[model samples]
Target: MPTAVYAGTPVTVTEEGFYLDPDQWREDMAPEIARDAGIDVLTDRHWQVIMHMRKEFAGKGTGPTVRALGRTSGVSIKELYLLFPKGPAKLAARIAGIPKPRGCI
Candidate 1:
């Protein structure tokens, strides 16, 4: 298994670069992951999506879809795109230290 160095700690990651275990994730990993994902900084709005994704993934056993994120997360779809850029769900999931969404590539 490949591991990513986050804040100097090794974190297991899938071939696609998502975390292998959500439990292994730490809040400090977010910024490093965000930097790797090209997100300059994670704002409160970004946290809104990240928290929602983590919450929903824990309950559902998978990351949420972009549509689901748009529907329930406090942030809007357009804003999500602006915050996460090209692929909100995938990017946010990566930063949140969760697995790639079932619906994502």
Candidate 2:
């Protein structure tokens, strides 16, 4: 299990998975927290992309392909790569608050 504290509240992850307080999820603060979780730095553009990806995954139950993600984010694949050297799969997963992908673990 992994845990992180936000605003004096503790969030814990167990075999069942992570639990976070929705109230604690402020857009301004999320990028910092995401970085602490091993993500690369995020800009406002990245936040827009990450949030969109999260919504998409919630609706579909699977992550998007890089091409789709780039289209949704309005960023080119080249731009995305410059921002996320490890690629979308790793950085986006962290920003979306999803568990690290299998290979990352």
Instruction: Estimate TM-scores for all models.
Output: 0.95, 0.63
Where does model 1 exceed 4 Å of error? none
Error of 1 at 11 (Å): 0.7
lDDT (Cα, 0-100) at 82 in candidate 2: 66
Q: Give lDDT tens digits, candidate 1, residues 1-105.
A: 898899899989998889989998989889989998788888999999999999999999999988989999988899999999999999999999889999946
| CA lDDT scores, all candidates in order | 0.91, 0.60
Candidate 2 to truth, TM: 0.63
| True-structure lDDT of candidate 2 | 0.60
Candidate 2 lDDT by residue in tens digits, 16-43: 3323333334455556656665555677
What is the lDDT for 102 in model 2? Answer: 43
Clashes of each: 0, 0
| Best lDDT among the predictions, by candidate number | 1
